[model samples]
Target: MLSYVRWYWPEEDRWNYDELDTDRWSLRHVELRGDGEVLAAASLAEALAARDSGGGGAVVTYERRFGVVPEAPFPPPDGDIEPVLETLSAGEFEQLWRHARNQLERAGSS
Candidate 1:
């Protein structure tokens, strides 16, 4: 139910998060725009957090894009994901990131 919404506008042709190279976790809800505007957005963390609201908020663990660990917990809503994501080994999570980067770079460079 959570998403790290990403978009690229061909005019500038850049990914349009508040910060580039900075991973984002939507606190409440946010709007993402591209082409003209309004691509997609939602209450990412809330949805994730809401799923396991009982105790410390359980994490649906998954390996990082290139991680050494079997599962990295989805970060708590208040915490940063980058630290946890750092556990990923170089080029370990390359499959997804490379594919997306290729697509976006191709799109942006065009």
Candidate 2:
């Protein structure tokens, strides 16, 4: 099982429970609710890096904690996303999510 996490808006300088998706072997989907608004959805690894990159000014960093994370279930992302980041489109995000699940299943030993 994967965990859901919330992130803050970097450029807008606002705090929102923005979400991210990570390669958790088995895709983990977290729907963030703001009173009742849907912010951007990102990966867990990106979120964490975005949080740290907040100080860079103007361009907020996207996708952090990647490339060296432990390879098991994967840890939750902090709140960062792609630079000049916008939420992933439904079709696009789902496609990636499905791919992650496929990888996890294939990696599993019968």
Candidate 3:
């Protein structure tokens, strides 16, 4: 499972939840594996810092699980992977930040 953090700016009154326009939103993906975990922690820390800086935007996090489809003839079936999103309270965000920061420090020492 890969964690993704995104910050949507300008705070729109209404949003089109049907689709994601990555070109306009600030996005970060964290891979929680091996050396990638260290980089992932750093990425999460960056997003947390931006959120804490009074950036006046909405910060959201989600987990994505990639799927593997069987090899098919020509036109393979669509293997759409939907992200699992969670709405976190302020305290939850703080806890996540603490955990990620700890991992980052541990990795740095190693």
Candidate 4:
């Protein structure tokens, strides 16, 4: 089955949750092994033009990784926080993408 993985910055929540907000999230298409390990992954933009290689139907996982920033004098330190992951069904993924795309088009025209 095909799966989608999204990595986003939780700090960006200050801005409303815009699904198509490229600044907030990065998306990829992933293939998993039978044991649930990631077999391979590709950027969504690359996968969109290609056909599904077929493993499992699309399962979408959103991961939020939080980081801590130091005060002005110091540069933003880089560290990993335990990621929060959520999985959504293919149908829900399609709906969210469709809505976001429509919103983007409307915004562009305006």
Which model scores highest in lDDT? 2
Models, CA RMSD each: 15.7, 14.6, 15.3, 15.9
Best by TM-score: 4
Off by over 4 Å in 4: 5-8, 14-43, 46-79
Q: Can you rank all candidates by TM-score, best first?
A: 4, 3, 2, 1
User: How close to the true structure is residue 39 of candidate 1, measured as C-alpha lDDT?
Assistant: 22
Ranking by lDDT: 2, 4, 3, 1
TM-score of 1: 0.23
> Residue 30 lDDT in model 1?
19
Q: Pick out the ten consecutive residues of candidate 3 with the lowest summed lDDT.
A: 62-71
lDDT of each: 0.32, 0.37, 0.33, 0.34
> Model 2 off-target regions past 4 Å?
1-84
**Per-candidate clashes, comma-separated:** 3, 15, 0, 4
Clashing pairs in 1: 65-93, 66-92, 66-93
Model 4: residue 89 alpha-carbon error in angstroms: 0.5
2 against 3, candidate with superior TM-score:
3
Per-residue lDDT over 1-110 for candidate 2, one digit per residue giving the tens place of the 0 to 100 score: 22333334455543322223354332334322334322233354544455566744312433221112222332325524522334545555565445543543444433
Candidate 4 per-residue lDDT, tens place, 6-49, comes to 33335632211112222323343332233433323334443332
